[model samples]
Target: MTVVAEAPTFLWLEITGRCQLACGHCYADSSPLGDHGTMSAADWRAVIDAAAELGVGMVQLIGGEPTLHPGLAGLVGHALAAGLQVEIYTNLLHVTAALWKVFTLPGVRLATSYTTRPTQPAMRRSRAGRARMPGPARTSPKRSAARYRCVSA
Candidate 1:
């Protein structure tokens, strides 16, 4: 007999709506129009701490683009410290060397959408054992074919 595992309950927190790239099919309606809102760092911390106290096991950080949040690293770190497994949905366009260092924390995973160019083979190879949310990029008339490839790959 096979036992099926139950899906864990998780909080999908929206910390900001700011994004450097504005994709055409973004359901959140995020844009580079600079009209995005951000949650205060204190508020974000409070939620993480509360979730820990409530015994929540997972938290998914989302946004127009979560990395655009000024205190993204701090927020993720707080959640990790609180004993929750964290995952993020990212476009992977802005992650720099310093940014990748943020994922060194235990129980953190990234599901990046490479709508244009896929992540470096070396990076994907290293992360093979970890959970990832990967998908092709959405297409629209706004972005050139070449630019879209860059975003989706």
Candidate 2:
């Protein structure tokens, strides 16, 4: 009897191990001093290509914070061009303009985690207040609308 291997429908890529924070609950033990893996842009591109060829329907880009990876935007673009849906898990802390642009692409989605610390008043704010916090919401109304559409779609 012959057996066939099924291709994976989902792929998770921990593109980097670096993060801006050392959260106590971090599963990867990721922190500011964490190791940013040696994979170069070309290497990541190849991996993305392979995943697409393997019939991966969705790819999740994760890390201590994947946004810290310099080639993230390019990687996202490559994955999308290969007809793969991309989901990025970020801390919403270090979103550069280039990354933000790719994130708004049709086949891409952004996800974030929020941990509340009662000791930190800022952390206790409602979801709406947190959404209006400084970093991620610094875009124009049109851009914000685009982001909303991308995220909500």
TM-score of each: 0.66, 0.72
Candidate 1 local Cα displacement, residue 128, angstroms:
31
Task: Report the C-alpha displacement of residue 18, candidate 2, in angstroms.
Answer: 0.5
The segments of candidate 1 whose C-alpha lies over 4 angstroms from its true place after superposition are 1-8, 34-38, 114-153
Whole-model lDDT, candidate 2?
0.75
- Stretches of candidate 2 off by over 4 Å are 1-4, 118-153
True-vs-predicted CA distance for residue 50, candidate 1, Å: 1.4
lDDT of 1: 0.67
Candidate 2 clashing pairs, residues 3+ apart or interchain: none
Tens digits of lDDT, candidate 1, 18-134: 666644445554545433355578888998988888778999998868877778888899999999999988877668676688876778899776433354443333432121213
Candidate 2 local lDDT, 68-144, one digit each (tens): 88878888889999999999999888577877788899999998877545534544254533453334644344223
Q: After superposition, how far is residue 57 of candidate 1 from its true place, in Å?
A: 0.7
